[model samples]
Target: MTYHRTRIRRRRAAALLAVLGAVAALIGHRSPPPIPSPTTLARQLTVAAGDHFHREPGSGALGTAGGALPDDASVFDDNYPGITRLDPDLLSALRRAATDAGAIRFVVNSGWRSPAYEDELRRQAVAKYGSEQEAARWVATGTTSAHVSGDAVDVGPTAADSWLAQHGAAYGLCQIYANEPWHYELRDGAATQGCPQMYADPTHDPRMQK
Candidate 1:
């Protein structure tokens, strides 16, 4: 009888251990991986989206031109994001600057674009410019646009140009290219000194950049 009792106890202990192991495995499988920390996200934003290397001699030169995108992609002006959902600080500064400047209308040709949307833009730009490099200097790869990280904006109108040039540094907003008078970014000069990471892939949809 004592032997029988010892065997039964051992059997129950083994069963319990097995059950616990199974449960632990299930829990581990169900949980998704943790998102990168804020620090890492900030770093990614810096490099992925910053404007340091993207700078060129004559960006924004076509602000006065109708349709922000190349003629082919511009066919869908019906598509770009509205001015309201852009970076809070940049948006606010634009409002202030626009209001102060009086009649300085800022044209938000694009904002918070998705990677997929960027891809289409790239396609149209490549068609127009004949090369990705040329298109990149013309617009942006979704990954590199300050707008991808919600830190940049495209502005139109020459009146705001001189104003932003003088005050943009004060508010942390800077132009992506010298030619494009309308594009602007938050100073975050420290946030992306060497241009840490692109906000998203140039081919990414604005929605997915985040």
Candidate 2:
């Protein structure tokens, strides 16, 4: 009777071991997740890089001064002080122009600068050019800067600039300086009379004389 009981227990143990071994074999044969192709991996990396580089509206990258912008930014995103602080007329014109732009998108690089931001840029420009005189061609004094007055916008991407050059006069947005093709300002009556001739650079503008 003891030997029979022992034999029964051994059989049960063997059955349990066989079931566990079968489960292990099934798990080992299961398929793994597919690896992404090189192209897919590269595209994912590019998107991640773009997200890392870009700041959302009102992210406070430069404290409250807030002039930096991303490529996909809209003129209507007023969460940014740079967009809200723009001259009303200029902002209105930009909105209208944006609506009619079709495929072309305006990417604001800089707008509505604080005095501190303007001064810092001026200092950097002076250092880059090795003289205040040469720097004046690029950066303006805070007191006389159109950016400080909320009257100017710097837009970018070569395609956007070209599109603006062609259609901007109708919206009163004219490139202010030949040297700075990205810079634009609203010119009153530009729609009817056409835009005024662009200055060679900011140095040629009478406004900078002050």
Candidate 3:
């Protein structure tokens, strides 16, 4: 009976290990993603500058938008979550990128989620995740918005993100948020210090938006 119980315990241990291994592969918890070379991404984004640095580091898999990117009239290219008109040079850069890639049309995963939309998303996250702190860590909203400036963006991949980090200087696009890997900004190296400096004014925040 003792030997039988020991065998059962070993079987259970083996089962647990198998389950953990499967979970690791599903989430890619072991290794880092294969980021593209700086040259490859520069070709992809249609920009080439020597001094570049990405503020955001990762990509969101179809966060708010559906599956792959779509060239829908409702979703304008290079717009914010609100579909606000983007900076002219910014638009030209993105448009040129799509025309060159010949693979994926530049589509907005989200142009802008309005203040109301942001509040709702926050509420939903708090309800599901059990705390505002947890929710905010995952989704940003309102007063702490990057969408208001019409300068921020969340690209599709780290490879692309890495490319932007390496060569986005000439185009004026910079990753914006600190914790959110998908968020970025086109600061253009204004007299501002960073997003924190730019958003210090309530006027720049979405919750403060009219």
Candidate 4:
């Protein structure tokens, strides 16, 4: 009876190991996305810049609508509605940060986004992630996205993000997500109280649920 029990335990352990091995193999087979080069990012920004004022056909919904930013976009560039439409306090803070940024230029990768533009992005995210639940980690619906409400901005290149991470609190701009280093929002008392803790991702944010 003892020998039989021992054999049963061994079989269970072997089955568990096989399952674990299969799971590991599946994970290992999934390829990570390629990191875009700086040039590629700049090109995408240029495309976004020119796409301003686009409208979604048949829906009467504004797509870019002057809300798409360019690679060389500055905080003070009000010509683009994207920059001009940001929450007034957040825009002010960004301008101040820009002046003091020095060699690290604060390039606005994205600012305000039209509901139509946001919806399109959400669709693309869902496609890329293979499900809305997984995509929610990166993109939110127009009603839930801070960008659509002009309360958030995505700054870049890598140097600018790093600079903002270090000195943004002084201007009340705070990174809200641990996963997106370039995304920032205005925190009213951050200049004095320091920034609050970051959410793991948008999926973890209470604001995203609504």
Whose lDDT is greatest here? Answer: 4
- Give per-model TM-scores: 0.48, 0.69, 0.45, 0.72
What is the TM-score of candidate 4?
A: 0.72
**Candidates 1 and 3, the one with greater lDDT:** 1
lDDT scores in order: 0.51, 0.75, 0.45, 0.78
Kindly state the number of residue pairs that clash in model 2.
0
Off by over 4 Å in 4: 1-63
Q: Candidate 3 on 1-210: residue-level lDDT in tens?
A: 999999999999999999999998889866778886523442232111100111123213222221122333222333222344444555555455435445443444434444444454556556655786655544456546554344444554455555555445445555544444445566555324332333422233465333
List candidate 2 segments past 4 Å from native: 1-66
Q: Which scores better on lDDT, 2 or 4? A: 4
lDDT of residue 91 for candidate 1? 71
CA shift of 41, model 2, Å: 33
Residues 1-210 of candidate 1 have per-residue lDDT tens digits of: 999999999999999999999999988886678976533442233323223212433323222111123211221133423344466776776666666666555555455555444554556666755677655554565666555555666554455667777666655566645445555666566233532233333333253334
Better of 3 and 4 by TM-score: 4
Candidate 4 per-residue lDDT over residues 1-210, each given as its tens digit: 999999999999999999999999998896889987534443353344335434233323443353655456777787777888898989988988988998777887788888777776777667755788876877788889999899999887888889999999999999998877889999988989999999988989999878
Residue 170 in model 1: shift from native, Å?
3.0
Using TM-score as the measure, what is the rank order of every candidate, best first? 4, 2, 1, 3
* Candidate that would win on TM-score: 4
Kindly report which residue pairs in candidate 4 clash with one another.
53-65
